[model samples]
Target: MRRTELFFPRYAWRQPGATRGDERFRRASSLLCSLLLLLLSACSSISPKETAVSKTGESTFKSEPPKKVQAFATPERLKALDTQEAFEYRLGPGDMIGILVWRRPELSQEGILVSPDGFLTVPRIGNIQVLGLSVAEVKALVTSKLEFFYIEPEVTIRVQEFHNNKAFVLGRVSKPGVINFPGKGTLLEALALAGGIPDQNKDTSLTKCAIIRGNDTIIWIDLEDLLRNGNMALNAPVRNNDVIYIPESSDEMVYVLGEVQTPGAIQIRSGMTVLKAVMLAGGLNKNANAEKVFVVRQQTLKGDVIRVDLKKLLESGDFTQNFSLMANDIVYVSPGGMTKFNYAIEKIMPSLQMLNLGFSDLESLGVMERLRSKIWGQSGFINSSSSGATSTTTTTSP
Candidate 1:
């Protein structure tokens, strides 16, 4: 057999006349070679190194290592931690104390008030200086004094009323006054005694709340962090005469007025827009003319007003008309045919005036409730019927 016959068994018939089997064998061999070449080309398209690098780069970009967050104490655990601090009640001036001696009725005294000089008068024991001394230390001192008259005298000291040590809580709290405690108290306890921050004033910054002690020392308590996030590290212990001030929040706020269900102030958060502010004010009322919305910015005394087409914004998906609102901005949705800029200002002037009044004045005049009712009345704006009401509203003219 020739070389071609050995390689392609039946395809060696080209010497004289090729048989049908010779052509079929040649076609099958060509087909098999084409398939092998295609397989080789496909395998060489991507190298092993390229595949490895692609996978490595994808994993590196797609996945990130988790961040490390510090552990914080839970509320229950923080309370338990406060209990671990050993606190002893110290005797001071104006503290009513009682001295009891076992089996010595004549020597015992009740209702003994400590004088301003921090001295307590006893029947046999002369004035003893008990100032700044704990109850246990005072008991030891009294026992030592009685040792001269009797053998092994057992003395017990009790504090009937604590009046010398006090902590003051002021600003934004429900009750801003002095709080008297017998022993050492924590900042949390002082706030609780002062009735905590009022619901209306929930925007008070706990991080800014200060604990002022003496003339030089001031400690800041992060009550908000502690209460919200269980961060007890800043929960400092309050001292006598310490002033805990919970300052009102200085965060920017936007007001939504006019034809809204609940026209009031809403905090300015990130990405807040006119539409969001209107929704926060309980959405537009039934008579609200969505096409005639106005945004009044009171950055200065004169203020600037911009007209917004809220109907187009919501129905036509025109986001460009839904402007971003700034702090102290007023979003007023007016009634139909009341599109004048001055009319919108007239609607919002009363609210702006009320904001300027102090909390005390507003409380005394019952202005908050009256203002709400007046805004929601049939007129749907400031009442023009009464001359006094008109004069008062005009005084706060923009």
Candidate 2:
């Protein structure tokens, strides 16, 4: 057929290369992955430990460790906090006094009110300034003035009513307000007048109470010593306009976690021991390794980790292993094998987060109901019989 070697060409179908949309999608996915990684790194940078108390009683998490625990005021130091000079009640304006002269009835005066200018008009002596002077000083001044009239005049002055004096008791007390003292009052007396730190079992911070005087001077009052140890040395005499502040509990907490039946923070009280705290946490769980209980105490910036053999303390009667716990301490009961500190912390993080959420708030958010439903499932409490039928019918009908 001489068809010019029949020029025929064979064609092959080939797969298409990557399109523009595919490249764009790949870039977007890479960017999304980078953003997710960045978010994870940011979250991981936050500190896991919380030490400061929030208004909701939740601890504020901080990256930096707390400063070392400062030594408490010693007995000698606290005793020396009182002023060396004895406190003497001084007369001021608006004060009513009784001036009596024994055997000299004519010169005795009753209900002699001190003038607004702090002066008292005597029978013979003219107006004399008694303001800013103690009772004894006023008596001596009046006696000196009466010396001109009698051979040796004897004068006695007594405050009939204290009108110009007031003390304030504020912060975390049942009754917080201005308190008027009949005469000289002590720190303890003022505290009693203010209802002695509201809810002594829960809200009061006995170790952090303070007595503020004037504008700048502040005296720390260790109620723990005064109430628990019976050391009244720090109960200094309260002066006029003095303010006693009983702050709410702050660091008075002990955290129990890891293998405890109830893992959470427990309020600390006087003479709180590891055994007591464990019991307060509903005792150890079945998986708890009673032999290796750890107590991490924050004595300073760096915490002190104490290893306790609860097995020895409970079974062998070695009480030395049952140590007294301090405020802001962390107790962790291991799970049989050797427990790493970081692993224990990881295990406790969930409990701390739960505590931070606050049970009341969680209940209000219906989380408790959801949790209960999950626990009971469909067969237990959350009935899935008629409800299940209704759901199936609705889905099938739709």
Total backbone collisions, model 1: 0
lDDT (10s digit) by residue, model 1, range 1-398: 66554444443334458766445445545554565575455446454655356644555435333322224334454454344357777778889999999999999999999999899997699899998898889999999999999999999889899977788999878889999975677777887889986776444333447777789855555555777777666577776677988766556678898999999988875457899889888998777899989999764556789999999988889989788776668899888664466566886676555444433343333333333343343212233244544322322222
RMSD of 2: 17.3
Q: Give the C-alpha lDDT of model 2.
A: 0.71
Off by over 4 Å in 2: 1-75, 83-87, 98-131, 140-158, 163-166, 197-208, 213-225, 228-236, 239-241, 338-398
What TM-score does structure 1 among the candidates reach?
A: 0.43
Instruction: Summarize candidate 2's per-residue lDDT along 222-256 as a digit string, tens digits.
Output: 77888777877766777887888876665578899
> lDDT of each prediction vs. the true structure?
0.71, 0.71
